[model samples]
Structure formats: C-alpha cells, structure tokens
Target: MAFTTVPLTALGAAPWEPNTTYQTGDIVTYGTDTYQCVQGHTSLVGWEPPNVPALWSKQSSPADTQPPTAPADVIASNVTSSTVTLTWTASTDNVGVTGYDVYNGSAVAGSSATTSYTVTGLSASTAYTFTVKAKDAAGNVSAASAPVNVTTGAPVVDTEPPTAPNNLTAPTVTTSSVSLSWTASTDNIGVAGYDIYNGTTLAGSSNTTFYTVTGLTANTSYTFTVKAKDAAGNVSTASNALTVTTLPQNSTQYEIIGYFPSWAAYDSPSFTPSNIDSSKVTVINYAFLDICWNGRHGNPSQSPDNPNPNTWTCQNGDGTVNNAPNGSIVLGDSFTDGTADGGYNQLVKMRQLKNTNPNLKLFASVGGWTWSNQFSNTANDPVTRGNFATSAVNFLRQYQFDGIDIDWEYPNSIGVPCASGQTCQRTADKANYVLLLQTLRQALDTAGQQDGKHYYITIASSANSSFLADAGGTSNWLSNAAQYLDWINIMTYDYYGPWDAASGIVSPLYNDPANTNGNSQFNINSTVTNYLNKGLPANKLTIGEPFYGYGWKGCNAGPNNNGLYQSCSGEATGGSDGSTYDFAYMQNTGLLSADSTGKYTIAGQGYTRYWNSVTQTPFLYNPSTKIFITYDDEQSVHLKNEFIKTKGLRGAMFWELNADRNRTLQSIVSNDLPH
Candidate 1:
C-alpha cells in the first residue's frame, strides 16, 4: 500500500500543514495515513509510505523568498518623539512563517508575530525608516519591506499668552467709581478671561475685558492693572498700571424750582429776607404770586381768577421796586411769564440776586400745584408748548434768570388735587411731557444765542411711586434732563407724612415690614434705581431730603415707633395740623439728637423716637397724646450720604433754605458733596 504523496516544493514559505492522523503511535497503514513536513524543517509526521520520497532533496535557494515581496506597502503614521508606530501588509510565505521582524534604518528594531510594529526611544526632530520582513523557525530572513520614513516635530513651547487687547478706554470716572472696557484678547490655546486689579490688590476679575471698580473714595488717587489668561491657566504678566485721580464732585451751583410772589420785590424786608449767606447758598425756589397763566394780572390777591397787572410788581428798580430789594430774588416765578409781556419786576429781581451773589443762579420755574393743570394742555400742543418755551426763555432773559425749573405737579397725572379734567389727565401726558421738554430745550437754545446764557431746565416732580408709575417718569428723567438741565432732584423726604390717610413709617431707607411692598413706595434706592434702570447717569441725580417732619394722630407708640409723638385712633390730622418747620426750626427747638445706637429721633408734640437700625429710618409716637411724626435727621442723612457715595450719585438737596438756614443741613451737604 502507498501513503499520500509528499510535495517538498509546496512547503517553501507558506504555512506548514500538519498531519491530522496518528497522534503518538497510531496505526500507520499504507494509504490510510499521510505524512507532512513543517516549514523550514525536513521532518515528516505520521507514517511515510514506501513510494514517498524520504529526506526530500533540500532546496537551498534562500529559504525566505525576498520576504514575500518585501512585505508590500509599509506605512508609518501618528509619529511621536517617544514612539513611532508602523503598519504593513502581511508578508506571504510558501510554507508557514511564524513571525515578522521590523527594521529601523536597516537594523532590527523589533519582532512581532503580527503585521504591525511600534518603534520607540527615537530622538525627537529626527528622521526614521521602518521595514518588516518574514521569519521562519529555520532562522530564515525574508526580503525587507518597502521602507517608510517619518520625521518627528520639535517639542512645543507654550510660553506666551494672548496678544494684549486694544481700544482700552475709560467709560466712566467718578470720585469712587471708574468703569473701563477694551477689545478682547485672542490666543492660540483659547483665552480664559481677564483680571482687574487696583494697584497690587486684586480688585476684581471678569470673563470680559470690561470692568468696574467700586467702593472707592472720592477725589482720591488709584492705580489699575489688567492681565489676560489662557485656557491652560497661563496668565500674562500684568499690563502697565494706570494712575488716575478721581474728580472732585461739585454742587456749587443751584437751580431753584417754586413760586415767587410778584410782591417779592416790595416785601424784601420779610419774604425777600436775606438770611442765607450769599456765598454758601447755591439755589433758591420762590413760589409764584402772579407770573403764570394770568401773567401780570394773575395775582390771586388782585383778580384771583383774571390777569391783574395793576398790582403785579417785580424786583426791577422803577418806582415799585429797588435794585437791592429785587436782587434778593433767586428762582423765578412758577408761571410761564410770557416773553412778550409779564414779570419785568421778577426779571429785575433776578438781576439783583445775580449781582448780590455773583455765583448765585436763578431759574424761571413754571407750573405749581394749581397751575400744573395747564401743563398737560400746553405740553401736548406744539404751538402751546413752543409758546411756553418762548415764554420760559423770555422770562429768563427779562428776569436775567440762569435757568428754568418746571413744577408741573405731573403731566396726565394727579397730585394734591385728584380732580380729573382735560388738563388734569391725558394718556399722552408722558410722551407729551417729554415733547414739552424737547420744545423748551430748543427754545432755550435759540434764546441762548441772544441772552448769552444756557437756560438750565429742571422739573419738580412728586415723590410717590404712584406718580412715578403713572407718568412713566423715573429718576432717569434726571439724566434725560441732563441733556437740557444740570441735575435731577428726587424728593426723597416726602416718603412719609399723613397724606396717605394711614400712619406709617416715614423716610424709610428700606421697606417697612408692616407695609410689605410699602418699601417700594418711597425709598432712595428705589427712586435712584428706577432712574438708573432707565439709563440715567448717577451724576445727574440729586437726592431730596426734607428738612421738616410730618405730625400725625395715630395708635401704637413703642420701640418700633419711638416714644415721641402721640398715637391716637381718630380721623387723620389735617395736613396743616402739624406746624411746618425747616431744619433750622428743629435745631432751634433742640430736637436734634442721636440715640446711643446712632439713630435720629425728634420729640415733636411730646413724643420721642429714633431711627430703626433694621429699617434705616426715623419714627415718633406718643403714648399719652397718641400722636406720631416721622422725619429725617443727621443719622439718617449720614446713611444717605454713604449711599450716595456708594452709588456714585450726585449731591443732595434740602426742601428749602429756611428749613436749614442755621447751616445744619447745609453743613451736611458741604461735607458729603463729592469734593
């Protein structure tokens, strides 16, 4: 019997074929079992037949055939300084080739049983070549694969941050505030954010290039530094520090808003009394007697309803007035004294006031609690409004007033008197009010050329939230007024009083818990915030602090209300029930005192109380008399002063000079004004 035939040529470089029959010594019958040779080895397995050739002729023709065509198409990718990976098509073998050998620059780099190899420890920035070959157990080496060369890149050095930003500039500058902004910085690794520093101290940080430094002292010197950061947390050295000195805040000029009786000139001995130091007094608001709708004939003492020029007097020194007497006048009448006719004496008095206090300013104020009704009508009509503007400038010229102040109780809104009429209420009042201001501004500018004066226009508005909301007027009105005027005065003091028909906290800096949302009703922060939110500039806002207190008859007088005024349960006290007194009257009465806790309290109407630390305001109540009064004092004013400093708002204002002629409140303003 003959065994399967053996082919020696087929076992050259291909995978070896093993014998499936016979394990250790299985029966080796002829034609039943076959024998085969392993790769690179001339050894036979199973039983060898007699016809089969034993010890086949050994072919010595380079057992490895050029490494199976040089392991076609070798490639190297994802190269690095530390390691280089190489891949290639598997080498072909006639018989069975166990593994492959990789070469680096013609040298054996590594050996693997698979088709891939990783060559490591090569210097960076250096070039390397890799090739693969087949290897057999007989120590046969096949032809080398096509060489693939790879050059590693140099090591990376991240030593710089993003380029410095551009267009760095100061947006706002105040005694204690400096706002700055700049273009963004860009970097290769991405920017993180920016850091702002005051001198060496880290003032603040922002993800943007804009930054604001707050809580600074006014008129002080400061240094600022800016730095840039990258995503990797790499920070650039701080930029050159910039040194700046805050500007001084000045309230040297004042524009009064109120009525000045036509007899103001003749009554200089009393009404025109000069109690205030001309040098110290900035502005004055005088109530009008007959310079508005009725013109010279509008005197209540004369016609009361019709124009009455017969008794209409002015400060002009003719036969009815004198220079010194008329000069006592500061602000003009709260009437639209027509430019063509009216208030020649008022104009004369204004010139006298300017001559007396060279720095003193006069304002031709228009509209009063009663006359404001015409504001809606005049403000809405372009012709009427234009006439009002012309009258305003003419009054300024005729009276030599420095500016104009509008006390139009409110446009399209009600105050003091809630009666509704065509002029009483109008939906277009708000927009019309703005239009009125614009028209006045144009007229004032037009008149400015001839008079050589810029008529500063201001408005006396209500201090109630209802007034603020109804007319869509806000503290921002001050900033808007800045376009035509100089300052916006917020009547912050009127937050209290018996006008509400309910006894409550007065001049509370914060909201009253009993009144929950009541805090929003009247507050310095609220009023100022309202204006700021409306885009009003802080420097243009002037906070109004009352120099007097409101007396009320109510119940509940204890620690909360302060044991001062009496608290009773009865019909509300007549608004006139409480004697109106200015800061002077309070100081003169020796009612100016601060508690151990730094709270202010007034013993008005046999009641004593101070400010609440929690509420930041003053209160008064009497147990026996059952009376209550709320007002402001030094302590409370101090808090407001600090707030103004914090918020970077303009200076403050007093209801009237007579309220603080003793310089009590004046000293406070003198101390707190920016400079």
Candidate 2:
C-alpha cells in the first residue's frame, strides 16, 4: 500500500476525547484575557497565574464575542390541569440562532426556540414556576428569564372510570402478588398521570403505564379503576373499572427446610430456590442422619474428634468394648470407617429427609459389611454387648434418630470380617447373635425410660445362604432376636453373582435352571419365604431393593449361546466396589435413560441392557455381538414394590440413599411404599 500526503484542512481537528470537550466557560484574565478553548487540550502561552490544569487558555479570536445569551421566558396559560403550557422567545446569537432552555423551579423542564411548549406530567390543580434561557452554538448560556409562576385549573374529575380492564383475573396462582399491569389510556394533554383505585379507594398513582397491586386477599374478587390526567389538570373520565379475583389462599403451601452434606453450595446464602411453593408435595423427606462414623461433624470449631465421644471412664470391661463417653456426637463420617468425628454422608441425608417430612422418622444404621468386627464380640458376651448397646443409646440421643438399624453381614460365617472372633468363634454364631439383640433391647429400653420415648430397633440381614445356614435351614437365632426388634430388612439383591461358578444372572427371579446343583435359590419369592419360614412376621419385614446392579464375566456367542450373557461375559468388567454410579452424575452429564416399557438402561460395552420388571433386576444382551447387560430401573422397582405390598411387608430400604438422590428410584418407591 502506497502512502499519500493529505492536506490538514481535509481532516477536522483530531477527534475530541468524548466528554473531555469542554463547553464554553468564563474568560480567564491572566496578564491579558485568554479565551477558553472548546477542547480541553492546552494552548501553551507564558504562564501568568499558574492555575489548575483544567483552565486551558487560547488567544481570543475576533469571532468570539460572548456567544448569544440564553433567552428568558415564562410558563403561560390559565389551564389549571395536569399539563402546563410554556412559552419563550428565541435567543439572539452572533452567529445565528439555536435553542432555548425552559426551567421548572430551577430544573430543566422544557426546551426549544419556538414560543410555546406543552409540558405534560404536571400534577392536576398544582402550581408551578418556569423560566427560559437561550444558548448559541458557541456555548454561551443566557441569563435565566424572570420566573413566571402558573397555577393549573381544577382537574376534571373522571368519576366515570375509563372502561374497566376486561376479563381481569387473579387465577389461583402461587406467586408473591397479583400484578395489575393495565392497558394504555388516552387524554387531551396525553395521559399525564394514572390513578389506581382498588375497590373504589385510591390505592396510588403512577405516571407510567403499569402497576402491581400487592398484599391482596387470596381467592377474593376486587374491582380496579385506572384514571388518566392531562396537562391542563383535566382528569380523563374514569376508564371502565375491571374486576378480577386473587388466587385462592395457598392452601397447601409448604417449604423444604433441611440440610445435608451433599447439598450443593449449601454453605452460601444464594443456594435457595427462587420460587418456592409448599403445597405440591403432601410429604417430604429431608434426607439424612449421621449415626456412626462422624468425620465431618459440627462446625469448624467444635467437633467430635476434638472432644471425643468415647472418653467415659466407667469401663464396661471385656477390653474389646468401645464406649461413647462424651455423649455428644455429630453428623457425617468419613467415607469408609466409623470414627469419633461425625456421622457419614448417609446420616446427613436421613436427617435432611426427616426435616422435610415432619411425619417421617429416621434410624441410624450400625455395622455395615465394612464394620462387622464389633458384632461377634458384642454378641457373645453380655458385658461387651452392654457397652455396645449403651453406645447405641448414646448415639441415638446425640443424633436424634428414631431408632437404630443393625446391619450385620451375617450371624455366622458369611463375610470375611466375622471369621476370627474369640467370643463365638464356632460355626454356632447364631445363638450369640440372638444374645446381642436381647442386650440392645434391654439397654434401649432403659435409655428410653430416661428420655421419655421408646426407641425402635431394626436389623438389616442378608437374604443369602449365610444368614440361613446350610441346607437353607432357618437359624434358631431369629426366634431369639425377633421379640426385641421392630422389623428386619432383608437384602434381596446380590443373591446371584460371578462368585458362582458360571457367569449368570446375579439377581434373578429364579436361580438359573441349568445349574447342575439344583440350586433353586436367589429369587424374590424365595427370599420372602426364607424370612417367613424363619419365623419372621410379614408385617415386621421390609424388603431391600438395589438401586444399582452387579456385573459378571466370561461368555461367548455362537449358533447356540451359553446361558451366560456374552456382553457381561467379557472379562469381568467389575461391578461397583461399594460405590456405584449415582443419579446425580446421570442428570449432570445427561446420561440417564428409561426404556419404552419403563426400564432403565445405561450404555456399557457396545450393548443395550435393560432391567427385568418381574424380577426387580437388570440384564443386558447384545444378540448381534451376543452380549448381555441388566440393571435395575422403574420396571424392576415396580415389581419389588408389588412384592412388599402383596406380601404385607413393612416397607423397603435401598442400600444407600445417594444412589438415586435425584429421585429416579425414589419416585418409583414412593408410589409403592405405604403413605
């Protein structure tokens, strides 16, 4: 690109920095009078009175006589209405003519070089003073004209309100107020003001178009009139009034008021929902209660670990016992182990649930698969058992649970943790387990007397062979423990697994018929029967349904495929190790899916899998690739709920609440559980 020389005149002075271009001001007499430059830019000359930087000076130009002074004028006319008429003469300018400034009591009200201006928005029957000043392009403001006071005539009354708003309505809404934004109005001086009448009484007035009338009775009808006023203080004849009713009183309005560790951004005030209505849900479950394993407990200053819940000096001997000495406990524990600090995430959720649902009750669960070491010792000896029971009481008192739920993996040899205890090391661990329950019952009873409330005791037992002993025989242990417990929650999900010799259905309606051992086990019917056969009252048993599923491995596809699902057959992809994917992740990542038949599915290894409604289970099968996948979904949940209702079961408890915190499984379960 070649450069071309440009003439100076071709371009206007360098663009003035916006707003920096100063308007004309008084001349500065420094040695000799120096004219003020329109641009704030400096015009250097010998300094006479070194002043502040803003006072720039330039030699006076012959063309600069004080620019035309603003012309003076007054608001005229006898109209005593909402509108006022103002008139002023054009200001004389040396260069030519420009505009005039009309003031309403020293404030700019109207402007023009013409002789008249209709100032709207004046109050009806109000008095106002206005003055005018003329200005020329050179930036000279003329002296204000003499003030002219004017009084508006009495406003014409619009006793006949403008046509009332048509079809005004206050639909039974749940919002904060009923808005009264209305249609526009016409007037002689234009609608200067609008008077809003609520049921014939003046509520207020606004110059603008819309208004929201608040604090009105719900489900009640009221009439409203919006009247317009003009510049002459003449009020328009009232628009026809409109009638509308307010929403019916919030009959069922309610609010969610509880907290859990998992509540996103709960530590901040902004986490609350913008619009809340309490009437939608007949019941609510706040979600958590920390029973044991208090890791993140209380606030930053006071915590269980800092003071310890187990410092009581009165030792219940049998050195194996762990006592809760302080009696003070907290909510939330670390992920794996039970500690002195606080309860776990599970407890937090339970507490929150109770807060939302006033009629709801919460229970603390003790001894999961990971914490079974204390069971055998507590079960065998009365002293150690007493300590355990006392600890349970202390926990309940501190955390506010309705009861305690015992989740021992098994009474005898089943899980690995209970394998080596000196107390009841034999295969006959069942009898010892019963003793433990009796001790808990007695202790809870004693504590209940002191607290004025009887505490409930429930157990979560395995539905598999281990709890039942060899040959599917009911353990004599149940007969002993039944009297002390409120109910038993039987876990029926993980009955079948890769632990079996072949890769087959982990949770099935029936054991694989092809099993050579004639093992007709692992079905909902069988599990329910097992509990009932063991002397359990149907009304005192709650079936446990899994929100997640287990996976298996090792299978191939061919003309005649083996019973093992080929997709699940590929080297064991590994089921969750105590941590299954949750619905929170499903919603956040948009990965949730429900089949047409209402089965839930998630993509795995190139195969589409569906849960079985009849079995309350899931399975996958890729016929082309010969794969099988299955997981639990709404269909499966429905089947499980039916089992609870038909069998007259107390209710159902999911393994963990977090798995479906977003309510995927809960929505289904809620429909099935007793109201």
Instruction: For each candidate in turn, give its C-alpha RMSD to the true structure in angstroms.
Output: 41.7, 36.1
Model 2 RMSD, rounded to 1 decimal: 36.1
Estimate, for each residue in 1-675, the C-alpha lDDT of model 2 and write its tens digit.
Answer: 232322223343332222222322323434443433311222222212122111333332344346565555454874646667776666676654435667889787754434566776788667788787766534466787788888877766443323223323322222223334455666434555678788778876655454445445657777877777654465655666677776674322221111111222121121111211212222222222222211111111112111111111112112122323212122222221122223123333434544455655556565454334335544544444665677778767755666776666666663532211112134445776766676676667657657877577777778775575532233455744665676677776666554444445554654555444335766667888887887666756776666655444444543335334332333344332211333434433434455566545654445555543444455654445443433466767777677677776767666544444455666677655535
lDDT of 1 by residue, 135-229 (tens): 65334567877778789866545666887665555545655566656667878856778888888898766665656565566689888878888
* Backbone collision tally, model 1: 44
Q: State which candidate has the highest TM-score.
A: 1
lDDT of each: 0.53, 0.49
The whole-model C-alpha lDDT of candidate 1 against the native structure comes to 0.53
Residue runs of model 1 more than 4 Å from their true location after superposition: 1-273, 289-357, 416-422, 465-482, 514-519, 558-581, 589-605
